[model samples]
Target: MTEEKIEQGTCLRCGRVATLHRGLCIDCFRKSSEIFTIPDYIDLTVCRSCGAQLKGKHWEYGGELKDIIEDEIHSSLQELSGVEVSLEDIEMRRGGEGLYHVEVRAVALFPGGGVIPTRKALTVRVKSSLCPRCSRIHGSYYEAIIQVRGSGKDLLRQEEAVDRVLERVDQIARGDPMTFVTKLVKVRGGWDIYVGRNQSARRIAQEMHRLYGGDYKVSSKLVSRREGRELKRFTYLVRLPPWRRGDYLLKDGTPHRIEGFQGRRVKLKNIETRREESVEISSVETLAHYPSKEVEMEATVLYTSEREIVIMDPVSFAEVNIKKPPGWKRRESVKVVRVDGGIYLL
Candidate 1:
């Protein structure tokens, strides 16, 4: 005789109907066969809704309704102390339906202990903020619901944590030097130097003398300001010591280097090449009875005294006495021309 076939029923563990050949559903089978229950601490708090976790805020536990409270405590400790911590062990006492109880083990590194379990245990309460499965499917930005087991320990000591983090940050910032910006201008008798926008040319001249030591004169020129207003811009003329201009030095720290005079020989290259020549001076005695302008004239220095020099125009034999002020010397040469002015060899 042949036996009749019977319909299958749902498995009590997973609620899925069993197949004709199998007594339990696939989900129940997998759960029963797995050797380990809780894989890691992070996994224990997975939201039943979306299974998403929290980040940034230290100790923030993100996930299902069961883990919200623990995550908050974790986030708080992390912010107070610069350390990473994890839940080590968990004991689920009562679960399912509307209530649950759990004991969680936490481990973190401390200054005193290299790595150790926290002496204070954490008991959390589990509550449903969102549906475990639905919350996992769709997330909520408006509200956060969590099931806390019990109040957890304050992992970080308050004052010490704040000072330590601040000190470390300050040390890093102080390692670099500060920097600023300014403008540079070339003065009439001075080299280019830096100055602020509000600084005056006279102020810069004085500063240059203080820093480099030189005689400076300030000149003013009109410049256009905004909206067609005219404003005066001052320029400083510095009389640099001759030695400063050249590669020589004097006992009084003055520069004795003559710009146009290269030793005793007078370089007539520029004057001879020019078509027209004019002479300027402080006095007209050296240029008396001479023409106002001249063309094609040869110059020569005859004799030089402490304060004046005697020069004669080689072309016309015209003689002239050129005055040398206190700063002038006999070793200097003067250019003589038929013109009414004496052109000194700069």
Candidate 2:
């Protein structure tokens, strides 16, 4: 009889006829080998201002610290860089200042149909860094200063105009969170606003000029010299006209009502002659300012006709007859302004 040779290799676990790998059969090795790799420690950064977590180079808005810590622990674990990790349970608690300890229980599922239960204890380090917007605001930094003033404008009107301009500026700032204003100062004849970004200041100046019909001029002053170059700070001057629409001004003893601003010129209508003219605002002197409410008085209608409306001044009871403007309703009570030697119905 021929001598028989027996296969010698046996599985490490069951002693079966199987190829051995690292002293284990293929099946046993797949079941026993460690296929998961995770770090004992993880590190992440949080924004000091907005509670945003830094993921790579981007900011992730995380609502709470515990949620961020949990997410960090889950994302840091990997199953041999290819296996899928299914989390079973996670427990995290604060260890100390900016330190969190996490205990995780998960299952590693292999592509080759193997599953392993895993338990890991990880420590996370939380570092605080200012977010982009908060960093810009930390130093009270500004890129532009807008000086609002007029040559002969009324103080009250200029002040009110600044209020309107600030409202629009606030709207822009809300749209772009990076744009901000550091200070809004009440200056003579107008307001001076310090803005945080050049684009914000430019936007404000442009919108002011477009809506209110003004002009803006820009200038820069050398703030610092560095490395053979000068660092200059920008200033924007928004020049509003001296008069606004519906304002009454006395020019050369004549009452002229402001129509509106036309570029660098002011449009006005003579209250007495009923003639309209546009002129450089500086040529006229404002001997008197007539604000509508301050100048208006309650006048009772004494008589009404198609061509004329007669009114009795409540203060002096003087019967006054005036030609009515078109579309006058001839109400029993009317708003009228009397100054110097003239009376006009509003």
- Count clashing residue pairs per candidate: 32, 1
Q: Ten residues in a row with the worst lDDT in model 1?
A: 142-151
The residue-by-residue lDDT of candidate 1 on 21-98, one tens digit each, is: 134443453345321122222323333343444343322232454455455455543311322357665455554543
Poorly placed runs, candidate 2 (over 4 Å): 1-44, 50-55, 58-95, 99-125, 150-166, 174-177, 185-191, 212-215, 225-230, 251-254, 270-276, 285-287, 324-329
Give the total clashing residue pairs for model 2: 1
| Error in Å for residue 162 of model 2 | 4.4
Model 2, span 187-279: residue lDDT tens? 766688877777878877777765555567899888889999987778888888655677788777767888877555678888767899998
Error of 1 at 333 (Å): 36
